[model samples]
Every structure is written in structure tokens, then in C-alpha cells.
Target chain A: MEATKKNSWLTENRRSAIAAYLFISPFFILFAIFGLFPMLFSFYLSFFRWDGLDPMTFNGLDNFRFIFSDPIFYSSIQNTFIIGLLGTLPQIVVSLLIAFALNSSLIRFRNTFRTLIFLPYITSIVAVAIIFGLVFNNQPFGFANYILSLFDGGPIRWAAEYWPVKFAIATMVFWRWVGYNTIIFLAGMQSIPRELYEAAKIDGASIGQQLRLITLPMLKRIVMFVVFTATIGSLQLFTEPLIFLGRGLREEGITVVAYLWRDAFVYNTFGTASAAAIVLFVIIITLTAINLALSNLIGRSKRRVS
Target chain B: MSTKEVGEGKFSIKKFFVYLVLVGAGLISLFPFYYMFVMSTRLNREINSVPPPFTPGNNLVENFQKVTDSIDFFGSMWNSVIVSSTITFGTLFLCSLAGYAFAKLPFKGKKVLFALILVTMMVPPQLGLIPQYYIITTLGWLNDFRAIIVPGLINAFGIFWMRQYIEDGVPYEIVEAAKMDGCSNFRVYWNVVVPMILPAFATLGIIVFMHVWNDFLWPLVVLRDPSVHTLQVALRALNDAREMDYGMIMSGTFWATVPLIFVFLLFNRLFIQSLSEGAVK
Candidate 1:
């Protein structure tokens, strides 16, 4: 009887283990085929020279070397950083402030405000580009220009020139993503214990004082996370510029991903596109490492100060 | 209420300024959308008028007809709906199952597998565009909705999220008791585990729904044919291929945005709470 009971227990354990494996198999199977394989294959293709249709030749370091000399690739990187910074820094600061306000008691219809603000981010980017195109139409009576005219600034040619194109893209990026980060920051703010704020209040800590002394310090990790995500996202920036330029025009607001798409699809240079993607991958990793180190330093310094 | 006096001396000009800024920012957030609605109603000729009709115009019906006729707008909408819902439901099922296993089940290599999933999230998928495209092409999934939907159905983030829910929301004692009663693992998950984590299911559902709807780059790559084009892809095609009127394009924009706005409004607090709660602890 004792041996039979032990045998039944062993069978149960084995059966359940099988069930657990079965449950998780789909994700692994899908990831293997779609995610991992493609990623590894792209790395291999970066070292080869081939258009989409042609026979590939194993060209060692040629694709990377070609990109180094490519002026458009360099310009695309410049545009990416320019647009990323223009959008990200303001977004971080503004989002923090907005989150602070929403968390404050003075604001009424708080949920309504958040919903309205976040609405822009959820709307299709294609729609955003198209709508902004009309507003920034550069004509004398264009919506943005007409608003500018109030300050005696004539039609600013919002999308016609280099800087303006970056500004336009930046503004679109800002409008779309600011609310998202605000919601994130606000969430972080709400999680801070109320007793601490009450204690600070008893000690006559002002709002600004509390914000600087308590809030920002506490939010350092979340802020870093937001910064990291914003960095990664901006690095892969593509669609807004692609459609905003009306498809054929790759001159203004072209991002790295946009440049990649154009190269792969327009120029049919698969090897070149793969190499650029690898370069982008390296840039993302290095920036992430830098950000991680900086955040760590800040975290340690704050701990020491306390 | 007591917060109003945190730093300020009394109810003064500063309070007024704070409200002003708040209201002003809200209006700025909404102004583009208002402009979009206004342009959607008006013809390009009227849209270009010196004071560019700040108010809604009467050309909505005409523009709607023009855009729909230029491209298969409704067809694309149907395609988007199918793609988004399929992926959302599929994700909810698959992610929740895997999450339960990783969170509750004692299996060999569980820790290593979870670690691998975490690692995958760091590798940005867009960087592998060429080879991913080749994978789709190899499988003959080009111009197929599955090319977009299938790859997206099993995101690492969703699995991580669901695992957190299962670990926190469901008690281990309950699973043990169910098993002692001779209940199968899947049955325990379906009856007890699922009902307990409905909130998680809803949050993940809405997040996936919104993402799949707005997804562009992948769909643009996969759907080569017009008939199978997702809404965003089809909209781009319409804009580039036709000499579209500004009103018509705005009309398409309005059409794409309205459904999401409605969904968002209904689930605003649910989404906000989940994201906040999920992000915080």
C-alpha cells in the first residue's frame, strides 16, 4: 500500500510538469520562429552584400564601411538626435510638471483632463501627420502661420526647411507622447506614501520645497526609466516623418528607421539596410548603458546626501 | 482641498495663474483635434481661406463620399478590426496561460525561461527588419494579416505583466486545494485563476487593442495588396496614390480616430489605474 501511494505521487508530479510546459510552449515557439531567428539572420546578413533579388556575396565589413562613408546615413543620425532631443527633454520636464499639477488638489475634472490629453497619443500617427500637414501648410493663411502673425511673424514655412521640419516633427512627437509620460509620472507620484507628504506639511515644507526635496528624488528611478524608453523610441522614429513628407520626399525630417525603410524598399539595398540596423542597434545599447550608469550615480549620490 | 495652502500664503493671484496655466495647457492639447474636425468638414478651397474656417464647415458628406470612393476605406477598417481583435484575444489567452505557469507552477528551467523572456524585451525588433521580412516571405505570409497579427500575438511584455498579476492576485493555497480535489491544471486556471484576474485581462486587452490598431510599420511591410491593407497602411496609400482633397484625407483621419476615442473614453479610469498601478509597484 505504501509503495502504491508513492508511485501515484510521482505520477502526479510528472503529469503536472508536463502540463506546465505545454502551457508555455506557444510563446516560445512563436518567439523562436519570428523574433529570434530574424534577429540572428539580420546579424549574418549585415556582413554580406546583396540587394533583395540578387545572389548574396559574403563581403566582410564592406556594408559597415560603406555606411561610414554614406553622407545620408550621417545626416539621418543627426536628424534623429536633433528631433529626439527636441522632443524628449521638454517632454520629460513638462510631463513631470503636469503630473505634479494633476496630483495637486486645485485641479478639477482631473480624470477628464488626463483622458483628453492622452487622446492624442492613442490617435493614429498617420492621422496626426496628415492633420498637422494642413495646419502647417506654409501659405499666408495657414493655421500655424496665422497664429504666428499675431506676433508679427510672417509665414514660418513650418515644413519647408530643415530646422522647421525638425521643429514640426518635434512638435508632433511632443504633442503625441507628452501625455503618455505624464500619466506614467503621475502614476509614480500617486504611489508615494501620503504620510510622508503630511509629515512634510507639518514641518511647513512648501510645495516647491517638497517637490525638490522629496518628489524629484523619489522619482529618479521612474524618470530614468522614462528617459530610457524615450531614448529607445526616438532612436527608432520612422512613420511620422515618412508620411509627413508625403511619401516621395525623403529630404526633410527623415529618421534612421525611415532611412532604413527607404534604403531597403526604395533602393533595394538589403545588405546596406541590414548594416544600418546593426549600427542603430549598437547606438541604442551604448546609450542605454550610459543612461544606466548615470542613473546609478544619481541614485547613489541621493542616498549619500540623505 | 487642504493642499491649496501647501506653499502659498493664501488664496491669491498665484492660484488664479495656476488654474489659467492648467486650462491653457488643456486647450492646447485639444486644439489640433478641434482643427482636425473643422478641416474634415470643409473643402480645401474653404480650408485655405485667409482666416481658415475655425468652425466646422458643411462639406462632411461630400468629403466622406470622396475618401471612401478613392480607396476601400471601409474594407480596410474591417481588416483592421479583424487583425486587432484577433491579436488582442489571442494575447490575453496565451499570455495569461504562460503567466500562470511561470508564476505558480514548479517546473524545470522556469527561472531560466523567464530570464530569457526578459532579455528578449530589450532587443528592439525594428533593427531586424530585413530578416524578419524574409521570414514572412519564406512562410508566404506577405500581404497576409497573419504576418502582422501572428508575430504580435505573443509579446514578452504581456507575459511579464500577466505573471505579475497571477503571482499577486491568486493565492497558492487555492491552486493546491484545487489540485487536491483532482482538478486538472487547465481547469483550475479557467475556473479560479481567470475569474480572479479579470481586471488584468481587461487592462491587457485594451492595451493590446490600441497597439494593434495603431501599428503601422509592420503592417506596411507585410500587406502589399490594397485589399488586405490595414487602415493606416490603406490611408497612406490613398494619400499617395490619389490626388486626394484635404477634406477627404481629414475625413479618413476622423474615421480612424473616432472609434478609439470612444473606446478610450469608456475605459479611461480603468486604463489609467492599471498603468499607474502596474508601473508603480
Candidate 2:
């Protein structure tokens, strides 16, 4: 009887395991076909020259060699970095301050403020770029220029010039993302134990001191998380510049991903595009490693200070 | 006594400053949408008029006509609705199922699978763009909604998110009890787990719906045919490849944004709460 019961139990357990596998099979099957295979295939495609219609020819490291020698490739990287920095640095500080202000004591209609601020995040980037394009249009009657007019400034070539193009694109990036990071920061702030502030208050710490000494240190991990995501996100910046700068307009706002897209679709250089994609992947991975290292250093320094 | 009064006065001043900052930031956030609306209501000539019309004009109906005349605005909207809902519902069901299994079931290789999902979340989807496109072409799924819907049906983040929720929200004993009562693993999940985790479903649904709605790049790449174009792609056509009428573009932008803004207004609290919760985890 005991042996029979044990057999039944083993069968039951086995059945459950099978059911579990069956349940999760969809994710794996689809991922293998659509996600995993393609990733491996992308690496493979980096070696071959194909123009979507023609038979692919094996080119070995020629694609990589061409990309390394290409000045446009280097400029695209430079544009991506400049725009990423222009967008991310001010965004981090501003969003942190916004989150801090929203979390302050006795704030009214906090949810209203949050909803309003986060409104831009949900709006389509296509729509945003379109709207901001007009706002920063090259015309004298452009909305940005109208504001300039108030300060006795003349119309600026917002789209034509390089710096202005980066600035315009970065502004769109900043506007769309600031509220997102703010909410993340606000969430981190809320998770902090209230007693930390109460204790600091009793110890004669001012609001600023409490924020600096307690909140910043405690929220280091969350800050690092925000920074890391923002970095990766900024590096992959594509649609805003694509739509903002419009097609066939060269030498400005051409992000790495945009460059890759143009290369594959416009120039029909699938091999070179794949090479660029791999290079971007490497850059992202390197940045992630650097970010992780910096975060760890910050963690160590905070520990020493405490 | 005098010093204490000064401190009290300082507190109120700081409070005022905080409110000022919050309200100022709120206005800046809102200005673009307001500008879109204003621009949509004005004539093309008035849109570029010096000082740019800050208020609504009498040209709203005309701009609306121009927008509809330029593109199949309503058709693209219906397409967006179809693609977004299908992906959203499909992702919710599949992700929740996988999440529950990962959390509750004593499955073999569960640790490795879950870790793989985590690693998948770190790798950007763009890394596989070329091959994915080639695969779609090879499968002859190009210009078809399935090209977008099928690949997006289940994502790593959704699976991870639902798993975290299930581990916290669902109890182990319940699953065991259901099984003890002759309920099959799938049956227990269908009956017991699904209802209990409706909140997670709702949160994940909102997130997925919004993302799929606003998604531009993949749809742009795959759905090139004008008839199958989603709202975002259609809007881009209106902006670039078609007409240069600012009034029409603004009107299209205004209409395209309305559905999301309406959903957002209705579920503003849930949206905020859900994001905050996601960050905490």
C-alpha cells in the first residue's frame, strides 16, 4: 500500500512539472524563433553583404573595416554622445529636484501635479517630434523664435545649424523623459523610512541637510538605476532625431540607431548596418559596465563616509 | 521667542517656494499639448503668423477636414486599436500564465529559465532588428499586422513583472489545496490564480496597451503599405511624405493623442500608483 501511494505521488509531482513546462512553453518557443534566433542571426549577418533582394556575399571583416574608416560613422557616434549628454545630465538634476519638490511636506493636489508632469511621457514620440519641429521651425514666426523675440533676439536656424539641431532634439528628449525619471525618483523617495527624517530633524538637521545626508545616500541604488537606464536609452535614441531632423537632411541630429536605419533602408547596406548595430551593442555593454563600476565606487565611498 | 517665530516664518516661505516650483513645472509640462490644440484650431497661414496664435481660432473644422482628406485617419486609428488590443490581451494572458508557473509550480529548470528572462530584459531589442526583419520577410509576414502582433505577444519584462506579482500576491497553500481537490495545474491557474491576480493583469494591461499604442519604429519598418499603416506611421506620412500643412498635421496630432489622454485622465491614479509600485520592486 505504501509503495502504491508513493508511486501515485511521484506521478502527481511529475504531472505538475509537465504542466508547468507546458504553461511556460509559449514564451520560450516564441522567444527562440523571434528573439534569440534573430540576435544570433544578426551577428551572422554582420559578415555578409546583402541588399534585401540580392544574394548575400560573405565579406568577412570588410564591413567592419569600412565602418572604422568611415568618417560619417564617427560623426554619428559623436552626435549620439553629444545629444545623449545634452539630454541626460540636465534631465537627471531637474527630475530629481522635481521629485523632491513633489515629495515635500504639505503639498496639495500631488496626484494632479504628477499626472500633469507625466502627461508628456505617454504622448507618442512621433507626435512630440512633429509638434516640437514646428515649435523650433526655422521660420521667423516659429514658436521658439517668438520667445526669442521677447528678448530682442532674431530668428535662429533651429533645424539647419548643428548645435541648434542637437539642442532641439535634446529638448524634445528632455521634455518627454523628465517626468518619467521624476516619478521613479519620487517612488524611491517614498520608500525611504520616515523615521530617518524624523531622527534627522531631532538632531537639528535642516531640510536641505536631511535631503543631502540621508535621502541622497539612501537612494543611491535607485539613482544609479535611473542613470543606467537613461544612459542606455539615450544611446539608442532614434525616432526623435529621425522625425525632428526629417529625412535626407544630413550632418545633424543623426543618432547611431538612426544612422543604422538609414544605412540599411536608404543606402541599402545591410552588412554595414549590421556592423553598426554590433558596434552600438558593444558601446551599450561597455557603458553598462562602466556605470556598474561607478555605482559600486559610490557605494564604497558612502560606506566609508558613514 | 523671536527666533522661534522667525523659524516658523521661514517654514511657510519654503512651503510657498515648493508649491511654486511644482505648479511652474506642471505648466511647462502642459504647454506643448496646449500648443498642439491651439495650432490645430488655426489656419495654416495663422499658424506661422508672427507671435503665433496662442488661442483657438475658427479654423478647427477646416483643419479637421484637411486631416481626414490627407490620410485615412480613422482607418489607421482602427488599425492601431486592433494591433494594440491584440498584443495587450495576448501578452497579459501568456505572461501571467508563465509568471504563475514560474512562481507557484515546482518546475524543472525554473531557476535557469527565470534568470534567462532577467538577462533578456537587459539586452535591447534593436540588437536583433536586421535578422528579425529578414525573418519576417522570409515568413512573408511583411505588411501584415501579425508581423508586429506575433513578435510582441509576450515580452521578457512582462513575464518578469507578473512573476514578481504572483510570488507576492498568490499563496502556495491555495495552489496545493486546489490540486489536492483534483484540480489540474492549468485548471487551478485558470480558476484560482487568474481572478486573484486581476490587479496585476490590469496594471500590466495598461502598461502594454500604452506602449503598443505609442510604438512607432517596428510598425514603421514592417507596416510600410499605406492601407495597413498604424496611426503613428500615418501621422508620420502626413508630416513628411505627404503634405506640409501645419494645420493638418497638428489636427492629426491632436486626434491621435486624444484617445490616450482620455484613458490617462480616467486612470491617472492607477497609472501613477502602478509606476511607483513598479519602481519599488
Q: DockQ winner among the candidates?
A: 2
Candidate with maximal lDDT: 2
* Each model's lDDT: 0.85, 0.88
The deviation in Å at residue A205 for candidate 1 is: 4.0
Question: What fraction of the true Cα-Cα contacts (under 8 Å, chains A to B) does candidate 1 also have?
Answer: 0.65
Off by over 4 Å in 2: A1-6, A299-306, B1-10
Candidate 1 colliding pairs: none
TM-score of each: 0.95, 0.96
Per-residue accuracy of model 1 over A49-166 as CA lDDT, tens digit each: 8887778999989988998898878888999999999989999998898888777655568887888767777788888887877777768667888888878988887766889889
Stretches of candidate 1 exceeding 4 Å from the true structure: A1-5, A198-204, A302-306, B1-9, B242-244, B278-281
Q: Isolated chain A: TM-score per model?
A: 0.92, 0.93
Q: Residue A67 of model 2: what lDDT?
A: 89
